[model samples]
Structure formats: C-alpha cells, structure tokens
Target: MPPAHAVTWRNGFKSAFWIANVLELFERFAFYGSKAVLAVYLANTIGLGAQTAGSLAGLYSGLIFSLPIIAGTFVDRYGFRRTLMACFAMFSLGYFLIGLGGMSAGQGLVQALGKTGYITSVLVLTAIGGSLIKPCIVGTVAKTSHPDVKALGYSIYYTLVNFGGAVGPILALQVREGLGIEYVLVMSSLVSLLLLLGTFLFFKEPEVEPIGGNPRTLGQVFRDMLLVFGNFRFISFLVIFSGFWIMFWQIFYSFPFYVTDVLQFPRFELMETIDAWTIILVGVPMTALVKKWRPITAMTLGFALASFSWLIVAGSPTVMAAIVGIALFAFGEATQAPRFYEYVAGLAPKDQVGTFMGFAFLPVAIGSFVGGPLGGWLVQHYLRDTMNPAMMWYIVAAVGFVSTALMLLYNKFFAPREAS
Candidate 1:
C-alpha cells in the first residue's frame, strides 16, 4: 500500500519514540523551569554573595551535564524504565526540598544544616536526577528509531528539547512573578511527578541491540574511558571547545544579577527564553545552510559571533542592546552546536562512538565548573566594585575569541593528521 522505497510515518516510528519524547519534554520542563530562577534564588533568598552563588550553580549544572559520561553504562545495565523511574522520583524530591529550603518553619534543621549546606544538598539531588534522565531518553530514541529514519528521529528529539527549554523559562518567570519563587519549585516538583506517573502507565522497553554491542562491564567501562583519555588530540580539542560553554553559561550564572541589580532590566529571564526560541526558530535553517562547511569553520564562526554578541550588551546597557546581543548570541549558538556534535562523531573510531560521544559532554561540564566562578568573579570585581559593569562583557568576549582562535589552530595543525 505504501510508496516503494519509502516508509510511512506510522511505520517508521514506534510508539516508544513519542512516549520517550513526551517524557523528555516534561523532564526538561522541570529542569529548565527550576534553572530559570536558581541563581536569583541563591543570591537573594539565601543571602549568598554573587560569586558563591555562581560557583554553586556551576557545580550543580556541571555535574548534571558531565555525570552522563558514566551514567549511560548504568542505564544499559539497569534498563531505561527503572532508571527513568528513579530519576523522576529524585527530581520530585529534589524540587520539593529546594522549595522547602526557603521555608522559615524548619528552624532546627535550618540551623543544623546551614543555608548553603541545605541548598547544596538540594542541588546535588537535582543534578544527579538530571544526569540520569538525559541518557535514558536519548538512548531510548536511539533504540526505538528505525535506522532509515534515525536522523529524522534525532531532529525531532532536539526540536522537542528546544521547545521545552523555551517554554520552561516563560512558565517559570510567570509563576515566580505571579505567586512566588517557592511556588516555582513546587511547580517543578509537580511536573516531575506527572512524568513519573506517565512513565509508570505508558512507557515500554524498546527492542534494541546491547549498547555498543554487549554492554561493557564496570571495569571495561573504566578501561574504555582510560583509552579515550589517552588520545591527546581529542582531549585538547575538548578543553578548547569548553571555553565556549564558559562564555555560554554566563547567561544563567551571572546575567540575572547583572541585569536586575545593575542594568535594571525588569524581566531578565527573558534572555534565556529568547535563547531557546531562537534555537527553535533558526536551528534547522542555519544548520541546513552550513551543512556543507567543515566542522572547524562552523565552530570557529560560531565562537566568534557569540563572543562579539556580548559587546552589544557591554556597549549599551539599554533593553534594545540586550535584545540584539542575545539574538546574535543565539545565532552563534545555532551555528556551532550541531557542527560540534558532528566533529565529535567524526573523531570517534568505529568501535568507540558511544565512548567518544559520552566524552562530548566533558567540555560542557568543564565550562560550567570553571565558568561559574569566572562569571561570579567578573560581576563581583567589575560590576559590584568598580561600577564598570560593561567591563565584564569585554572579558567574556575576549574568552570567546580566544576559544575561536584555539579551534582554528587545532583545525590547521591537528586536523591534517586525519586527512594524511
């Protein structure tokens, strides 16, 4: 009944794909929803310094992004449904405790744990939960999609991710403005619970091969990591690539405080929302335009554009400048993000694709760990002390350009080995 050599949508995708994506959407909704206001909550509610708050945020996000390196093996052993169940439970409990962190009712535990301790525990819980969720959902997509349409399946997965990201901030901002910050956390908890319920009711394991062939044992996993780390060129490329994430994370780590306390922007969360929206709007089209370019060229251009975007904000503190800056930064993000993945995929040997892809998150993790403190320092030193807030952007811009140059050098000097 179908056209020759073409699979119908109904036949190409299994129900697992839809279910996995739906779960992914809600998981991101909860994560980004909480992330939208986490920095402000840390700085204002708990009375921490800007620098300290940024560092904690960075640690939390860094762990969330990085832990997936080891989490996939665990999922491969334990199965997606069980891992997802635990993740949802952790997310629910973590969000609830985060909201509870603000309550004045628990005087005894508050005194015993201390504010920073309480917040850090909650962050750790959330990060661990998030780390598990990413791999499970992504792995599910891979397991379920027919090979012929796998690329389209991933495209759908990414689109849903960006959509959830865009919607999460807007929802969080509205909830925070309308009710209170505490309620926002409560909302995230509820969303996680909803996903947990969905998983229990609907999710079914998909048929797939053992991950990367028969799943590697714990010792084998460790050995695989050691082998991947032995590649000097790969490690260096990741470190250089990490510089971009350091610059990227400033939006979440420092921008809220910068805008509210210094620039007086009423709705700072809009910056994050705009970023997600731009990704959704232009990601496909831009990726299409540059599909033919070398990965290094795309990555270099992306870093350069993102680096320059900050200057627009630095030069003028006005709302219009902020819009222009964020928009340009979004374009830069679209340009580089897919190419970065493609480059990483190319770097992997046939057998180590999963291992290499797992390591791809290393840069994001490194960026968050280093970038958090760096952003905080920029704010505390330049904006808070000198009354020269725009100076911070200059430094950030410089970091981006430096990263861009490093990538170019890598391409020029290191890349030739592959061709040769």
Candidate 2:
C-alpha cells in the first residue's frame, strides 16, 4: 500500500515534472548564457586573446565539475528543497555580479572594499559558484522521483536538460548579438529569478526521503564514496569512458576558435550555434529510435558517431559543413547520456543505489578537467598549423573511436554484467 502523499505525487508527476522542465529551461539559459558568449566576451570585451580566453573558460568549466563532489553532500544534508532554494538564489547573485560589467563592478568594489586588483578574480569565482547549481539540482530531481517511474522521470529530466542546453544558448546568442554580452548576463539573471520563484512555490521534497542504512554522518558519506574505488569495475568504466568526453568537448572548447581563425566562416559563431539547434530538432527523434539498444552498446555507438562528426569539418571546410559536424556530435551526446546512467543505476551495489549513483558523475568531472586544456592546446598548436588545422579535430575523433572500442572491450571482459 502506498502512502497517501506518494499517491498524490504520482497522480501529479506530469504536472510536477512540467514545472521542473520550465525551471530547467531557465537554469540552462543562465548556464549557456555565459558559455554562448564566454569566449567572445573574453577576447573582444575583456581583452584576453583567444587561447587565454579558452583557457580561462576551461578553468571555469573544470571548477563546475570539481566543486560538486563536496557540494552534493551539503545539498543532501541541508535537504534537497532547501539546497535547491539556495542554489537558485545563489545563482542569481552570481549572474548579477558577472553581468554588472568589469568596469562597473570594479568601481563599486574599489569604493567599498578599497581594491580593484581582485575584481577579475572575484568574477571568476562567482562564475564557479554558478557552475555548481546544475548537478546539485539534477541530483535532487533524481533523489525525489520514485523507483518504478524513476526511469521515466529522469528521461523527462534529461530531456529538459538537453532542452535547456539548446534553448539557453540560442536565446543568449541572440541577445548577445542584439544588445551585448551584458544583456545576456541580465537575461540570465532574470531567468534565474524565474527558477528561484518556481522552485520556492512549486517544488517539494520527494515523498520518500533518501533511505539508506541508518542515516549517514557527513564523514560516513565521504567514507562510502571512498569505498566505491574498491569496486574495480566501476572505477575502470569511469577511467575508460573519459576519452569520449576528451573528444566530445572539443566542439565547445575548440570549434569556435577554429571557425573564426582558420575556416573563415562568415559568422564564426555560427559553427558553435549549430550545436544547440541540432539538439533541439533531432534529440528526441534519435533518442526514440535508439531506445531499444543496449546501454553499453549505445555508448559505443555514441562515441563512434562523435569521432566521425569531426570529419565533416575536415572534409569540406565550410560553415555548413561545420553545422553537419555539430549535428554529428549532438547525436553522440544524445545516445551517451541515457545509456550511461542506465548502466550506472542497474549496476549499483545490491543495497547502495544512492551512494553508487553519486559516483556516476565521476567520469564527467574528470573528463571536463582533462578535456578543456587538451582541446585548447590542440587548437592552439596543431590546428593553428595550416596543413594540420583540421587534423586537430581528427585527433579528437580518434579519441572517441578508440574510447568506443575500449568500452566494448571493458564490457566483454571486466564489466559487472555478461554481454548480451
């Protein structure tokens, strides 16, 4: 027999998830708002050169992943609802500080704190704080949904994530072109406000609390995560899967600069622009067709497709060709997400679902940290050389294809389950 509250929540899951989707839209808008213009704003607006800008942006990205290992615990302890409320509110503050402009923020800070030397550093830190919101919220959503429908629930959530991924960037790009980077900042802040309001009003704690062996102390959670390493299979997967991101992330980290510097695309941004557009148009249909595929098999296909996507840019060397490249990359991402998590949830230790689940993001954070600098360096060196500019992408593609092979091999010999 279900609890009365669980029954009520089940009845309204659709409506409940719709609100989550809307909030996700705004959350993504805030996130990609920064990304859409981050490189351009750094080079053109902040006076950093392309490589410096990419490195700085990469640093921000790396922190987003790094901070969450600890932040997730704080969120879990404080209660998902409280943690979520604070996340949106904190996110709004961070976006405001970013968009207030370097000069404006500098002048205000110098007047109040009697220092301007630290303004850029402070702004960078603020961006890092903003970066922490996504994982925490998504993690919360997962914690809140029920076991049976949880699969459907997360699919809805993941769709919202991709939906936001595409929607936010495009919206921010248009605003950045029309008004300025500052406008995107302002727009992101407003969207943050919408998220805050919606979460405060509509979001609730899951009817079922996160149940585990007697509630864990803060130290115990850390100890449990450390225990994950004892299971070689999970750690091996996280290690091998990192190569996929090493390739996939280049579309964001390196592709923009490549379009502007080498290919001579009419609008350099258009190459990057195609990513969100393709995901919006094609994510659902592709996901539907591939739903029946095995998880690791889908992952293998995902990485292989990603590796292949890069060749489009190499083959034709046109803006339209680059859009085709991004579409290919999006196909890789769409396949990778669902299958990866399904593998994680299904393979969790007998009684450690939530604990095992938290470690699932291990590969992502690792990938971002490694991939960012790798992409930046590859673009600056190999890609900058005329004979090899497109070859940099080939290296990225190779990484993906190699990873796909390695993942299949891991499944065959080392993974928990026998091959289908």
Candidate 3:
C-alpha cells in the first residue's frame, strides 16, 4: 500500500463505498427524523404521559444501540447485503406500523394490543432493524476503501451521519407542520422501503478477506462478550462515561416537553437540529484545535463545557439561550467524542483491540437505557409539579460536573500510567 498522503481520495474507493454511504445517509435520515418527534408524538398524539413516553422512547433507542453487539455476529454470519435487506424490510414494516398506530383508521390494532403495547412492540422491531445498519455500513466501508484512505473513508462516513442528523429534524419539523406528525413515521417508512429496493438493486457485497482468518461463531462472540465484561477497569470507564450520553440524550428525551409544555414552542423539532449542525459546521476546526491534547484532557474539558452549557439555559430560559446552550454542548461533543475512540483503543489489550472497540458502544446503550426514564422524571417533577423547570437543567449539569470530576480522579489514580 502507498503512503496515505500520496493516495488520491477519488482512486482509493470502490463503487460499493459510495453506494453504502448513500444508503447509510438515508438510514440515518429515517432514524433521526422519526426520533425527533417520537417523544412529542407519544405524549400529544398517542396520549401517553410524559414519563411513559420518555420510557418508551428510551427503550427503543436503547435497543437500537445495544442490539448491535449481538447483531454484528449475524451480519458476519450472513453477508452485509443480505443483512441490510432484512434490516430495511423490518424498518419499513415497523415504522409503518408505528405511524399507523397514531391514526384513527389504525385504531383496531392499537386497541387490540393497547396503545403502549402496540408502539412498544413495533419500536422493538424497528430497533432490531436499526441495529443491523451500523456494522454493515461500517464493514462495507472497511472492505471497499483502500488501506491508505481508510481514515478518510471513515471521516466521510462520519460526515454523512452528522449531515443526516442535522437535516432529519428539519424534515420532521416540516412534516409535522405540513402533513401531521403521524406522517413523519410514514415518511421514514417510505424512505426505508426505497432503501430496501436500493440495497437489492445497487448494493453488492464487498469482497474482502475475513478478519482473524474466518468469521467467529455465535459462541465465540458470546465468549468475547464475557472476556470484555471481566475487564473491571474498562467496564468502570464505560459506566462513568455513560453520564455524558445521559446528559446528551436530554435533547431528545426531555427538551420537547420543555419546549412545548413550558415555553409554548410548537417547533421544538427544529431546535433539535442545532446540535448536529454545530457538529457539522465546527467539527473540523474543533478537531484541529484539540487534536494535540491528551485524550483524557480533551475529554475532561469537553465534559466540563457540556456540563456548563445546561447552566446557560437554566440561568436564562429563552429560545436564544436554548440555541446557544445546544451549540455549546455540540462543541463539547465534537471535542471529546473522536478522542473517545482513540482512548478506548489505547486502553485495550493488543490482541483484544477489535473486541474492546466493539464493546465501546456500551456507554451509549447504558446512557440511553438510563437517561430516558431519568429525563422523563425530571420533566414530570421539576416542570410539572414543582413549577421550577430551571432546576432540571441544574441537575443535569451537576451530573456532567460529577462525571467530569470522576474522569479527573480516574486519570490521576486508576488510569494506566501511560494513558494518564
């Protein structure tokens, strides 16, 4: 392989690279677009209480991230193209059912299962579909890109992910306003159906050598899971880092209620775009600024910034304040998030790098599973009962502060000396 710098980006990729990325963009688009309105739809449209809505949303999001661990093994057993086909088929059906559950015409089924049960069942199915996407898309990128430009390939992938994140909410806002919120899920279903056809027509399985000689059996994957769980230091790190995601997920889990119920804003979905847009606009500059800092230092500073961002909104409850706070949070995320992977890889035992990297997603899963209920509780307690919504953000900020402090303590004492 040639030096990375000497390789031209155009020549370093195969046809599958572009196809996979395009598919991923729409997949993210469908996921985030529906997610942008999920909590609000549940509360206002489906008549669930705020806490119940948050719990359901969290369950769906949690399953999406957590299932990938097990789902990746299936992707390896099947091929990427086949797994993707199955994924989109489920996405289409699950999203359609969810949308259907919101309409009067769909009342028979909703009443049959109960609204909560109907939504939860479909959401679990949708999450399972979503779980297959990441590994397939990422694996395709790895197989399709030349070794020299693999970094650039992943960078392109990351950019599209954020692009989808940034735009999905905008689309949701429009659909919610113009067509109705139920149509947003229908929109996602339509997109998934298109992706299913695209996968069938355009996406070819990339030819690449299997890692570690052959694909691991499901038994081996489970054994690897056990090995990863046995590493106390790593598990502790993942648990502590989950605080960041718990804080981060508030944008989806709690912010809608805050905007609509408290601030009387009808367009909270648009506000959801700020975080992704901030990352898209400033990611490069932020990466450049923090690239030279130690991973722990960058992460600590990032956590502090994210923590402090909430206080900005807490002190002054206004639309502008909310925007500024979300932007600041995104800056903090961009600063630390890339370095997080670097830190994890560095902490892994040499032979177990792949295994450790795979499990690196655990913090996100933990955060979503825990954060949803927590966010809902905060909304119900602080906003609904106490009539002091600002206190909610203060508590969120405090979590971040504590997490940052813990990271500092870990760096000083428990982290490997070289890592410190």
Candidate 4:
C-alpha cells in the first residue's frame, strides 16, 4: 500500500516537483521582468534605433530557446543542483551588469565598453543562463510527477509561469516608475540571488531512470539533431506552426513601439501585464470548455481569435482597445498552447522521443529570429515613416490568418487522427 497521503496541493506529486515549480516562478520573474521593458529600454534609454533594438532582442530570445540541446547534455552530465546554481549565478551577473552599465554611463563604466557593446554582452549572458533553466526545471517536473498526476503537474507549472509573467511586469513598472530603469535590472538580480540560495539549500536531485544507451556525447546529440531534421513532414509542420509565433512575438517586439510611438500611450507596459492576468483569471474555465475539441480545430480557432485581437487596436487608438486585445490574446493562448504540446509529443516515434522533444523548441527559435527584425522593419517603415501606423497590425493579422489556414491544410493532409 502507498504511504498515508500527505495533506498537499496534489496527492502523488513529490516535494521536488513543488520545489522545481517555485524555482521556475523565480526564474520567470527575473526573465519576464527584464523582457517586459527591454525593447523600450534599448530604444529610449540606450538611444538605439527601433530596428536595432528589436533585432538585438530577437537574437537574444531566439538563442535562449534554441541552445537547450547543448545545455541539456551538460545538465545530464553535471547534475541538476549544480546546473541550477550556475544558471542563477549567471542571471544575477547579467542583470547586475546591465543595471550597473545603465546607471554608470556618464561615469564612463558603461561607455568604456561602448553603449551597444555593453547591452549586447548583457543579453548574451542572460541567454546562456535562460537556455539552461528551461530544460532543468521542466526536466525536474517530468521526473518527479507520478504518472497519474503528470498532466496536472504540468498544468500547475504552466499556471505558475504565467503568474510570474504577470507579477514580474507589475513589479517592473513600480520599480521603473518609482525608482528608476536601472533599479529594474537590480530587482531581477535580487530575485536571482534568492533562487541561487534556494538551489543550494533545497534542490535535491530527484531519482529517475537512466537512458537505454550510453550517456549522450556531443557527437551523439548532433547526430540525433540531424536525424530530426531529416524527417520532412515533421519539419514542415513545425515551420508552419512557427508562423503563429512570428505574429505572437510582436507583443514584445512591436507592441511597445506601437503604443508609445504611434498611439501616444504612456502605459504600454499595462498591455503586457494584461495577458498574464487574463490567463490567471480564466485559463481554467477556458481549458475546460475546449477540452473535448480536436487539437487542430482548437489551434485554428486560437489563431483566428489572436489574429482578430490586433483589429481592436488597429481600429481604435485607445489604451482600452489594446488591453482588450491582450486579454483576447490570452484566451487564444489558453485554447491552443496545451493541445499544441500534446500534438507534438504524440508525433514522436518511440526511439526518437528525446530527439523530437528537443527539436520542439526549433519553431520558437525560428519565429523569434524571423519575427524580431520583421516587426522592427514594419514599425519603422509603415508606422514611423508613413501615416498608416495601423498597417503593421494588418500585416501581423495576415501572418496569423495564413498560419491558421496552413494548420488546417496540414490537419487534412498530414496530421494523424484518432480515426486513422
């Protein structure tokens, strides 16, 4: 018989899962806190052009999603506790450097390195740190949850992540407005310090089964990656899905510019915070309503809803429209994201499960890499140079509409169905 059930959030989940979840919260806190304000900081404070700022932010975000193949191998070898500690330390160092650099430019510290040089270096450091954290925390969740409660565990984990995304920007707004932009980075560094301490004291590596083959060498990892690339159907589907993200990522790359530069709104960060809040409030109900829907159908609707969200902003130049758009976007995210992951995991052949899972991030990386400069260029040419600022949203909506159509076509032709 199982040991007497402990009074806890969930009966079967191990303490390690909760610990990993808490750590994920802090990790996201630092990350989103920095991200929510980064585009504006680059353009306004660093005095970089919008195109330059968006491109830099895109490169950083793309690498963070893409570099986990290498990082996961290191984590497998080095163990989770050490890897988590290193990641937190790197976050602290990166955020601290950005804060110090921004605060000390006139004093010649930041200027000594060149303004762009210092900022880019900070981003590179954070990307390396961010890349490592995703695999470690999600891997922990996968290891610690009992099979019966595994889905619930991930649901809770995602909810906490969205919660952190919500809280991070609110805290950033307060720090940036009440304190200063420099203090916002300092705040992120402080959160990283807490995570480092937590990792050292409480992060006991959970027990998990070993892989069937020999430990993954770098050569083996590369070979596995190439194998994934050789699967044409899978690669094509992922590329098609990447179009959604190409549009979605504009929240980070384009929304702030659209609000502040075009709409003349002072509270652009409010739009960022709204999506997270909507996720927190209605995610459960929305998920329940769509639980029986086909994954492809749900995803197509998600794209449609999210695509239409931009129309609210395009038609009206009010902050309220932007807020409503973000809320709608959040509901759309709730409809599609969970099902999307399930679909991807189901597609993997048994021997290639690990390989396929790692490649799952490829679409995200591709989207950011493509989206960043594209968003910047759109804002620069259509919004700043011309009278039709709203044309940017139309372009973003077009991407989403095309992606939704592609998903439907893939479903008809390629997707494996329950009836199949």
Candidate 5:
C-alpha cells in the first residue's frame, strides 16, 4: 500500500507538484503582467506608430509562445531543475532590460536609436527570454505528475495560469498608473527570482519509466525533434492547429485593444470580471464536463462560438454586450483548452511524449508571431474608424470560421485513431 498520505514537502511527490504549480503562477504573472499593458505602453510610452507598436508587441508576444522548441531541447538535456534555474536567471535579465528600456524609450534626447528602432530591439530581447520560460515550466510540471493524475494536473496548471493572467493585469494597472509600466517589468523579474529559488531548492525528478529507445540527452532532443518531424501526418496536424491558435490567440491579442479602443472597459475591470468568476469557478466545472467531450469537437465548437461572439461585440458595443461576448469567449475557452493537450498526449507514440508536447505548443508561438501585425493592421485600419467596426469583427470572425472548418475536417477526415 502507498505510504500514509502526507501533505508535507517531505512527501517528495506532493512537494514537487505544488512547487511546480506555484512557480507556474509566478511565471504567468510575469507574462500576463507584460501582456496587460504591452500594446498601450508601446504606442504611448515608446512612441511607435499604432501599426508599428501593435506589430512589435504581437511579435514579442508570439515569441513567448513560439521559442519553446529550441529551449525545450536544451532543457531536456540538462534536466528540468537546471533548465528552470537557467530560465529564471535569463528571464530576470530580460525583464530588467525591458524595464530599463521602457524607462528610456520615449524620453527626449534619446533618439540616437531612432526611438522606434530602439524600443523594438528591446521588445525583441524581452521576447527571447519570455519564450524560454514556457515549455520549461510546463515540462517540469509534466515530469512531476504520475500518469493517472497527469490529466488533472495540467488542468489545474492551466487554471492557475489563467488565474495569474486575471490578476497580473489588475496589479499592473495600479503600478502602471501610479509609478509606470517600467515597474511591471521589474515586478516580473522579482517574482521570477522567487520561482528560481523555489526550483533550485525543492524540485526533484519524478520516477518515470525509461523510454524503449535510449533517451536523447540535450543535444539529442534537438536532433530527435527534426527526425521526428519526418512524419508527414504529425507536421500536417501541427500546421493545421497553428491556424486554430491564430484564432484562439485573438482573445489576448485583439480583445484588449477592442475593449479599450471601442468597447472601453473601466480601468482593470475587464480582467477582474474574468478572474473573479470564470477562472475561479467555471474553470474546474467546465473542464470536468469537457473531459467526456471529444477534443476536436470542442475545438470546433469553441472556434465557431468565439467567432460569433466577436460579431456580437462588434455589432452591439454596449457594456452588457461586451460582458456577454467576453463571457461566451471565456466559457468556450474553458470547454476547449483541457482537451487540446489531451488530444496531443493521446496521439503521441508514448516513447516520445515530451517531444510531442513540446511540438504542440509551437502554434501558440506562431499565431502570436503572426497575429500581432495582422491584428494591429485590422484594428488600426478597420476598427478605429467606428464606421468600419463590423469589418473588424468580420475579419476576426473569418479567422475563427476557417479554424472551425479545419476542425471539422480533422474530425471527419484527418483525426488520429484511438489507442487500444
């Protein structure tokens, strides 16, 4: 029988999982804190043109999602603990640079870097560090959980991520309003320091079975990622799902711009509504329900509903309408998210599960990478005019429509087979 249950870190497994969860919260706080104010800060403080700021912020944000493939391979070699410590250090360096840069960005007499050129460079550097943190923290979490509880663990993980997303911005608003956006970067660095310390002291590798083939060390994980992609079906799905994320990501990329520019949420109230209710209450319940729903099916429904909700907000523009639209968006997100990973994990060839998980996150990176410029253009050219507002919705709706069509195709024609 299992040893009597202990709630202490001395219990090893519980310590590892909870510590991972706590670190996940801090990392997300950093990410969402930056995200909460990035676009506005870029345009107002950094003095990039509307188009330039949006494009750069989008690209930087996407990098946070995209750069994991390279980082994951590097970390897999050194082991999760070492990789995490390294990431935290790098993250602190990057955020501090961003804080220093944001402070200097638009001030008079600093035009030597041509204002725009200088700020853009800093954002890109920030992206480099942000990109490394994601897969490493997640991979660490995956390493800690037992197979039977892995699904529950990730669900909890994503929920905490959203919780942080919900809270980080509200905190950002206070700091941004009182001191400045520069402080947001500094704050993220501080939290990252705590997580770095947490990992160095407490994180321990899980007792997992060895792979059938000799496991690739760090150098090998990179070589293996390239080799594994030789499978046509896997690449095809990854490409298709990239499109899905392109649509999914707009909740972050476009919603803030839309709400503030057109719908106009009162201060940080937008994040508060979602954090207070949806993440805290709806997350677990919706996840439990979706456990029985087919992931592809949920993806299809989420895309379709969120697309229509864009139309609803665009067309109505009332406070209640915005609330309704965002609520639908959040609820749909809840239904679809847990399954996204389940489908990936279920499809993996067991021996290379970590590689596949790393691969699956690539689309979030790609979508953000592209969505920045595209969403910026759409907002600037279409939505800002007020008369052309629906066109903005039309474009966003089209993106989701395409994803919905693709999900249907996958469900009907391209889906992977279930294991025996």
Candidate 6:
C-alpha cells in the first residue's frame, strides 16, 4: 500500500464521507443556532426566571450529550440512513413545537402541559434527535474513508463542525434581531426539515467490515456499560475532566445573561461566535504546535489557559474584553480537545477501547448538568443581587484554576507515564 501522504484526498474519501460531513455541518448549525439564544429566549420571552432557564437549557444540553451512548446502540441495530431520517424528523417536529409553545399556540397538549412543561418536553425530544447525529456522522466517516486518509477525513469533519458552529450563531443573531427570538426555533426547524430531505435523497450507508465482529445485543451493550462504570480509575478520570466542561459551558449558560443584562450588549450571540471562529482559525496551528506533548500535560495547560481567560473578562468588563476572553478560552479548548480522546483511548483496556471511548462524553453531560445551575446562581447572586457582575467571572475562573490544579496533580500521581 502507498504511504498516507501519497494518497490524494479526492481518491481517499468516498461519497458517503462527504455526505455525512455535510449533514453534520448543518446539524451543528441547527443546534448551535437555536442554542445561542435559548437561555435569553426562555428568560425573556417565555417568562422563566434566569435560574429556571439555565436549568432547562442545561437539561437539554446534558441530554444531548448523554443520550448518544444509547443512541449509538440503536444506530448499530438500525441502519444509519434510517436512524438519521428518524432523527431529523424528530428534530423538525421538536423545534417546531418549541416555537409553537413559545408562541402560546399549541392547543391540546400545550394547553394540557402549560407552556413551560410543553417547551421542556419538546426540548427533551429535540435533544433525543440531536443525540443520534454524532455517532452516525462519525460512523460514516470511519466506514467511508480509506485507512490511509481517515485522519484527514476527520480533520475535514472537525473543520466543518467549527465552521457550522461559527456561522450558526451569526445566523441566530440575524434571525433574532430581524424576526424574534422564538423564530430562532423556527429557523432550526426549517434547517432540520431541509436536512431530513437531504438525508432521504442523498445519504447512503457506508459499507465496511464490522469491528469486533457482529453487533452486540442491547443486553450486551448494557453489560458493557456496567463493566465500564465498574472501572473506578476511568470513572474518576471522567469526573475530574468534567470540570473543564463545567467551566466551558458558562460561555453559553451565564455569558449570555452577563452580556445582555449586565453589559447591555445587544449582540451576545456574536460574542459566542467568537469562540467557534477562534477554534476554526487557531485549531490547526495549535494542534500542530502541541502534537508532541503528553496528553495530560497538554490538558493541564489547556485547563489553566481556559481558567485564566475568565480573569481577562473580569479585569476589564467591556465588549473587547469579552471578545478577548472568549478567544482565549477557545484557544484552550482547541489545545486540549483533540488530546482528550487520545488520552482516553490510552487509558482504556485494549479489549474495550470502543466502550471506554463511548463513555468519554460523560464529562460533557456531567458538566452541563452541574454548570447550568451553578452559572444561573452566579448570575443571580453576583449580577442581579449583589450588583457586582465581575465577581461571577472571578468565580468561574476559580473553578477552572482548581480544575487545572487537580489535573496537574492527577498527572503527577495517577496518570500513566505513557499518557502523562
């Protein structure tokens, strides 16, 4: 076989790879677009308190990350194309219902559950749909790309993901400003509807040899989950790593309220866009620079950088400062995010690498679950009650600092030397 460098990108990847990635781009676009304004919409338009809105938003995000484990199992059972079609269908319905609930228009169920409950229910539905996307896209990439060019395939995937993330919020800003916040959900629904059609028309399941032989039964999947959870070391690492996401999630959970409510900034979503754009611009070079570092060491540095970024905003409470702070945080994210999976794979038992990797998303779920209420409380206490909003970022930065210190200690003590 020729060396990977000899292979042309056009020859190394199949049509399915391109299709899957394109779908992933718009899926992310739909998701982030709605998410950019969800907190503000909940608090301002739907009449939920800041804390309640945060909690709901957190619940939605947490579910989106957490459900993929089970959802992946379903994808394995059902074909990818069929599962994707169902997922997009749910996405369309869920987003539309959320918008309808926001407008106080649903008749039977909306009236029965009330607006808050209806919206919450729809959010959960939407999250379930969102859960199916990543596994399908990733599986397609793996199946469709030649072994020689799989890494490049994933690089392309990551670039599109960031591109979608950057553009989604910009679009959200336009939609929210021109139409209304609730129409953001409508926009998401429309995007999903288009994706549903695209999937039906263009997406084909990539054929590849199954890894680890035939698919396991749902019973076996559950058993594997239990076995993974039984590994105290793995579980402990996941719990510790969750601190980064807890800090990271604040950009969405609290930063929106801080920008609009505290700084009187109208384009808070634009600030959110800065993080994605930074990652897109800096991620490749940053990855190249740290390609030789130990995973734990890189992660420790990333945690420290992300933590310190909040202090930048806290020191100077202005739009430029917020922009700079978010950019810094994105740099930290770009540094550690790729290495995280590498570290997890190294830590896993060789026989259960896939199982362990599946559980790696746990930290994201845990972070959202915890960070939401914590962010809401910070906003309430520091931003609203005490009238000292800068303290909120201080607390956020402190959380990152503590997490970074813990990571350093973990590297020194518990981390395998190979990983460290």
lDDT of each: 0.84, 0.68, 0.90, 0.82, 0.69, 0.87
* Ten contiguous residues with the weakest lDDT in model 5: 6-15
How do the predictions measure up, each by TM-score? 0.95, 0.81, 0.97, 0.92, 0.83, 0.95
By lDDT rank, best first, the candidates go 3, 6, 1, 4, 5, 2
By the lDDT metric, which is better: model 1 or model 4? 1
Candidates, ranked, TM-score = 3, 6, 1, 4, 5, 2
Q: Relative to the unseen true structure, what is the C-alpha lDDT of residue 104 in candidate 5, on a scale of 0 to 100?
A: 52
* Local distance difference test, candidate 2: 0.68
**lDDT by residue (tens digit), candidate 1, 197-303:** 99999999878654456775778768878988998877888899898999889988888877787778767778778788988899989999889987877888889
Task: Give the winner by lDDT.
Answer: 3
Q: Give the alpha carbon lDDT tens digit for every residue of 1-420 in model 4.
A: 455764334567788888989999888878888888887777777777778788888888999999988898878888788898999999898888877766654438667778788788888998898789887988899898887778778888888998898888878888899988778888999999999999999989988797797667788889987888888777888898898888778988889888887778766666788888998998888788888887777788888998888887788877888888878988887788757866776666767776787788788998998898887788778776786877888888888888889888887888667411
Task: Kindly list the per-residue Cα lDDT of model 3 for residues 257-344, writing each as its tens digit.
Answer: 8887777788998888899999999999989998899999899989999999999989887888999999999999989986898887
Candidate 3 C-alpha error for residue 389, in Å: 0.8
Error of 2 at 334 (Å): 2.9
lDDT by residue (1-420, candidate 2, tens digit) is: 877666344563544455656677678767876676666665556555556656666666666765676666666567666766676777677666656643465456645643323334644565555555665556656655556677667777766666666666677768877987767777777777778888889977654454666544668767976888787877778878888766656766777777767776534444565666777677778778779998887888888887898877788777777878888888887777667878877666768877777777777666766776776677667655444777787777777778888888888877777332
What tens digits encode model 5's per-residue C-alpha lDDT throughout 17-86? 7877888887887778777777766665666645776788777877767666666666656666777777
For candidate 4, the clash count comes to: 0
Top candidate, metric TM-score: 3
Off by over 4 Å in 5: 1-14, 104-110, 142-152, 194-219, 227-232, 266-280, 342-357, 383-387, 416-420
Cα-lDDT of candidate 1: 0.84
